[model samples]
Target: MRYQIGPDEPVDVAVVSAVSAAEECAPEALPQLTEAVNPDALNEIFAPKDEGPTRRSGTVSFDYSNSRVTIERNEYLTVEPLDVIPTP
Candidate 1:
């Protein structure tokens, strides 16, 4: 599943929203956001800096709710199941 974050929306909210959607549950039903990553640190790392060009080309990945979550600096979030076995 892929989700887009609003220009002004906090990354943490986007993460929670993604996880909730993937798990078919409400955001509040999921584990604490901090368990996956520090919300403040995440925002600060991806937030536009005052000096130099804005960091717009990076990705952060972490495990959340039994899913692999990838957050892109371009405001895109992707969630995928982490423990799937392929059938040959």
Candidate 2:
């Protein structure tokens, strides 16, 4: 999910975890439900200094049985490099 932060925006980015409905609602195991979510899976993709309001797109994969989540691939919105400067 890509969100635009204004020029003077004050915000904090955080990584949490993925939750499964089957695991979260079990009455017997509350602590295990918390453990199933991996905090490391939450990653923050920050924009470069010269770039602002960048658009990022990516695919994510998750395996509930093994508790595995991987960011498959991603694309960044950028401008093409200029081969030569125009003469005014």
Candidate 3:
């Protein structure tokens, strides 16, 4: 599953929402994202600095709510099931 973060969307919120949707569970049911990553730092990494240029590159991956979640360029995000069995 893939989710796009709005220009003003909070990274932490986006992560929780995406993970919840991917896991088919309520956001409240999932463990706190801070348990896996620091929300403040995550936001800071992607946030523009003093009207500077937007973040151009970076990727963060972590396991959350039974899925492998990834954030790229602070805009594109994806979640993949951890239990999937690859078939050749």
Name the candidate that leads on lDDT: 3
Question: Which is superior by lDDT, 1 or 2?
Answer: 1
Residue by residue across 34-56, what tens digits does model 3's lDDT show?
78889999888878778767668
Tens-digit lDDT track for model 1 on 1-88?
A: 8999899988888888888998899888888988878899888878898999889788999888778889998489998877772436
What TM-score, to 2 decimals, does candidate 1 have?
A: 0.88
Off by over 4 Å in 2: 1-18, 22-38, 45-51, 66-88
TM-score of each: 0.88, 0.27, 0.87
Clash count, one per candidate: 0, 0, 0
Residue pair clashes in candidate 3: none
User: Which of candidates 2 and 3 reaches a greater TM-score?
Assistant: 3
lDDT tens readout by residue for model 2, 4-84: 334333211111122223233334332432354443342333323365655455544433332333332222111111223
lDDT, candidates in the order shown: 0.86, 0.31, 0.88
